[model samples]
Structure formats: C-alpha cells, structure tokens
Target: MRTQVVIVGAGPSGLLLGQLLHKAGVDAVILERQSPDYVLGRIRAGVLEQVTLDVLAQAGVDQRMNKEGLVHTGFDLLFKGERHRIDLSGLTGGQKVMVYGQTEVTRDLMDARQAAGLTTIYEADDVQIHDFDSDHPSVSYSKNGKTQTISCDFIAGCDGFHGVCRASVPRKSIQEFEKVYPFGWLGVLSDTPPVHEELIYANSPRGFALCSQRSLTRSRYYLQVPLTDKVEQWSDDAFWGELRNRLDPEARENLVTGTSIEKSIAPLRSFVTEPMRFGTLFLAGDAAHIVPPTGAKGLNLAATDVKYLSDALIEACVEKSHAGIDHYSTRCLARIWRAERFSWWFTSLMHRFPDQGEIGQKFQEAELDYLIHSEAGSRTVAENYVGLPLNFGE
Candidate 1:
C-alpha cells in the first residue's frame, strides 16, 4: 500500500490529523496496535480550551461536542478553608473551556474517519517504520501473520510515550527532559451530580484534591496520594471521606457520594523531547511530551501538536511548500515549553511535598492567598487555562 502520509496511531491526535488532512485533499492511512474497543475504553480527562474546540471544528467533528459538552466560565480554588472563584471568561476577554470527555472526542473523530471511509488498520502487530531518514520512507506491520508494507511521503508518530515511533529514534539524536513527582492522583468517576456547577481545585493540610466533571450528571474527582499507595488500598467510602476533608465547608455540605464506576492511581510527571521531527517522521501528542494533569494540558498539547503537524503536512503535500514543515519543531517547542512551565508551576503550587515540610505549607498558603486576592495572578491562571493562542511563525 502507498499513501501520502502514514499515521501510526488511531488515538485522537492521529485520528484528528487524518480527518483534517482528508478535508484538505490529502490521503493518509492510520495504523493502531489495539482494537477499537480498547482505544475507546481508555478514560481520559477532557478540558477543551478555545484552541482545541476550534481544532475539533476544523476537523468537522464538533457537532456532538457542541451539543453535549458543558461550558464553564469559571472555577474555584479552595485553600485555607476558603473557596475563591476565578472567572475564566472575565479574565480572558470571554474565553472559556468545555468540560467534555476525551473518550467522546475520540469517538467523534473515529466516527468521522469511518464515515469518510479512511483506512485505519487496528490490531496491527510489530509495526515498523523504515527509511524515514531518506525521502523514500515506508511503514510495515503484521496483520493476520502477513507482512504488509506502506510507502508514504511522511509518517506521523502519535502512538504515545511507549509507542514505537519515538522509540525508533536513535538515542543520540534525541534529548529528553523529565521530572517524576513523588505523589500520584487517585481519581474516581461516578454517575453523580457535581458538588458545584464548576470545577473546584483544593489544597488542604491532608493533600490536594480536584472536583471535576464530565457533565451535569457525571463527575470525576481526584485526591493526592503517596507514590507508594495502591488503588486497592482505598475503598470508595474511604476515598469519599478523605475527599470531604480536603474540600471547603460548603463543598462538603453539597458533596454527593455514590458508588464509583472507575478508579485508578496515576503518577504525575513532566516529560518533553526536543525537536519533534526526525527526518520524515514527526511525533505528536504523548509521543513527544507529557504534562502533569494539574493544569489539564496533556490532551490540549497533543491537539495543538497535531494541528500544527496537519497544517505542515498539508502544505508539504498539497501546496508543495516545505516552509511550514521547516518551522514545525521550533514553533511547537516554543509553545510547548510555556505549557510545561505552567503545568510544573501549578503542580508545585497545589501538591504537598513530603520533602518541603511545614515551611512548604506556609509558603504555599501565602502564595495561594496572593494568587486568589490579586487580579493579576488570577488573570494569569485564566489565560493559561484557556490556552495561549497558536503561534505558527506568523
């Protein structure tokens, strides 16, 4: 098989890229190592910035999102037993975020791909990228014990952190930066009304907690836990009790508890790889970077990566222009580092550091006091939360 582009993942980033390219009259094929059910089963947070929403619309897959996604203009920061609201739209000149599920976004993209009859090979095994360093690049994978080869002009590595695309790069050519936090987030999903209309981020003596939602009827909450903790160690009741301790009095009163449908523990980390491009291959999404969920930048960053990538690829394929592709890495890195800084800063501000001790708590409280009380600080949070505009070498 031969194609204009070979996308080595069926995740949202890859799927969205394929959709955008198809709309732009470019032909691409996608390959996935997992079944459709497996891909859809992965639960992920979806806090859509203005940029992400626009990208989804650009891919022509925002019909369902627009209908079902909840729009939030503000959120609360609970610290020292007080709840302080930050008006996101007010601070960002009417920019807001959408509370949608990542799963839903994937489904929409998948459906669009199928409706358009795009080629996507799922459960492809031993997928290998070949000759990416030269102009004649190709991808190979085993399906039903038969080896199939696809020669493509370019390859997109949206497979994820553990994916084969990034792994294929020689270590010497890539430089990595990573910081693993000492704690993890224990998250729960339930079919209960949210404690409040908008999300609430809390910092308490016990730990940090987040009261987030997927919709008015479905809520997702998280509590900070030690790195050594296991998901089985905390019962639903215990989780609820601990969460109650972290929330403000009003949230405690309004909190509704129910059986959790899903529960897991995820460690926090910041990871980024320099120069997202390797010859004819380009890495997007988790394949290139990871942000701690503190600021909810993971999926948004991935979306932006693909948005830039799709545009560059389209320029290369349709307009016969290498200018966009030439500046892809520099422009992406510029925006990515800013988001990395914000995620790191927000995580540091909200989480409890075992090494920081009592002094750390006092410092956190002082900073939180100033952040909530000061308009400038609040606007800063709002701007980053709504997402900085895309800078494509304008």
Candidate 2:
C-alpha cells in the first residue's frame, strides 16, 4: 500500500487527523490494535474546550456533537461549606465547554470517516514503523495472520503513550519528564440525573470530588482515593457514602445515588517528551504528552497537537513547503507545556497530596479563597478551564 501518511491508532487523535487530511485531498491510513467495537467502548473524558470543539467542526464531524452535547457556561467550586461559581463564558468572552463524552466524539468521527470512505485498519496486530527517520518511511502490521506494509512519506504517532509509535523511537533520542501523583480518581457512571446543571468541583477536608454529567439523564462522579485502593475495596454503597461526606450541604442535599454502570480508578500524572518529531515521524496526543484530568486538558491537548500537525502536513503535502513540518514539535510543545502548567496547578490546588501537612492545607485554603474573591484569579481559572485560544503566542 502507498499513502502520504500512515497513522497509528484509530483513537480520536488519529481519526481526527486522518479526517482533516482526507478533506484536504491528502491520502492517509489509520491502523489500530483494537477492534472497532472495543475502541468505541472505551469511556474517557467529556469536557471539550472551545478550541477542541472548533477542531471537530473543522473536521466536519461536529454536527451530532453540537446538536446533542451539553453546553456548560460555567462550573461550581465548593470550598469550606460554600459554593462558588466560576463564570467561564463571562470570563472568556463568550467561550464555553461542551460536556460530551469522549466515546461519543470518537463515534462521530468514526461515522464521518466511514461516510467519507477513508481507510482504517482495525485489530491490526504486530504493528511496526520502519525507518521513520530516514528518507523513506513505512509501516508494517499483521491483519488476520497476514503481514502487510504501507509505504508513506511520513508517519504519525497518535498511538498513545504505550503504543508502538513512541516505543519505536530510539531510547537515546528521547528525553522524558514525568510527575506521578500519589492519589487516584475513583469514578462512577450512573443513569441517574446529575446533581447539578453544570459540573461541580468540590474541595473539602476529606478530599476532592467532582460531579459532572454525560447528559441530563447520565451522571459521572469522581472522588479522590489513595493509590492503594482497588475497585473491590469499595462497593456502590460505600462509594456514595464516601462522596456524600465530602460535598457541601447545597450539593450534598441534591445528590442522587444509584447502581453504578461503570467503575474505575485512574491515577494522576503529568508526562511530556522533548521534540515531538524524529525526522519523518511526528507524535500527537498521548503519544507525546499527558496531563492530570483535573483541568480536562487530556483530550484538548491531543486536539491541539492534531491541529498543528494536520496543518503542517497539508502545507508540506500540497504547498511542498517543509517549514511547518520542520517546526511541528516546537509549536505543539509550546502549547503542551502551557496546558501542563495549568493542569498541574489546578490539580495541586484541588487534590490532597499525601505529603501535604497542615501548612500545605492552609495554603490550599488560602489559594481557593483568593480565587473566589479576586476577579483576576477567578478569570485565570475560568480562562484555562474554558481553554486558551488555540494559536496563542504561536
């Protein structure tokens, strides 16, 4: 097979990038290690930044998301028995986030890809990228016990952190920076009505909790837990019992509990790699960086990476200019680091670190107090939460 670019991973980043390229008259192929059903079944973050919504629109896959996704203008922060609303749209000049599940976004993208008749190889095993740093690059994989290869001008590593694309890189050529938080989020999905109209992020003496929704009828909630806790350690009753103790009165009174449809614990971490490109190969999304989910920047960061990478590829393929492609890593990293800082700061402020003593607890309270009372501090939270302009300081 021959293509302009070969994308590893059929997740949103890879599919979004392929959609953008196909619309621009560029030929690309997507390879995924999982089945299509498996890919669509994974439940992930729902909060979509304004910039991410724009990218979905640009890819011609925003119709369903816009029609069905919930629009959140602001979110509430509960601290010290008080509820404070951070007006996101008011602070960001009419900007807001879309509360749509990540699974739904991927489904929409998959529909658009099929409608466009784009090429995607699912359940591809033993996938490998060959000679991405050389003049000619190619990808090889096994489908139904048969091996096939794709010859391409460039390779995109949208396969995520553990995916082959990043692992294929020479260890000596990559520099990694990482910070692993000591706590994890124990999340539950239920069919009950949400506790509030918009998301609620609560900080209490017990720990941190978040109440969000996939829709008016479907709710998603999270509570910070120790790293050592397992799913079996907490039953549905225990989960609700613990969540209620951490919420303020206003939020706690309205909360409804039900049997959980899904339950999982996710560890918090911030990870990034220097120079997202190696010769003809480029990394986007989790393949390149990761952020704590407190700020809802994980998928948005991927969207920005795809935006920069897709534009650069189009310029290189159509205009025959290598400038954008050459600078892809630098441009994407500039934005990635900003997101990292915000997510790190927000996570630090909201979560209770095991090492944080009484002094640290006081600092957390003071920061939240200032953020609630000061317009500038509130606006900073609002701006980052709704997301910064996609091309800022570029």
lDDT of each: 0.94, 0.93
lDDT of 1 by residue, 265-363 (tens): 999999999989999999999999999999899999999999999999999999999998888888888889999999999999998999889899999
Q: What local lDDT score does residue 222 receive in model 1, on the 0 to 100 scale?
A: 99
**Residue 38, candidate 2: how far off, in angstroms?**
1.1
Candidate 1, after superposition: displacement of residue 111 in Å? Answer: 0.6
lDDT of 2 by residue, 365-392 (tens): 8999999899999999998888888778
User: How close to the true structure is residue 110 of candidate 1, measured as C-alpha lDDT?
Assistant: 96
Q: What residue pairs are clashing in model 1?
A: none
Best of the candidates, lDDT: 1
Lowest lDDT 10-mer window, candidate 1? 385-394
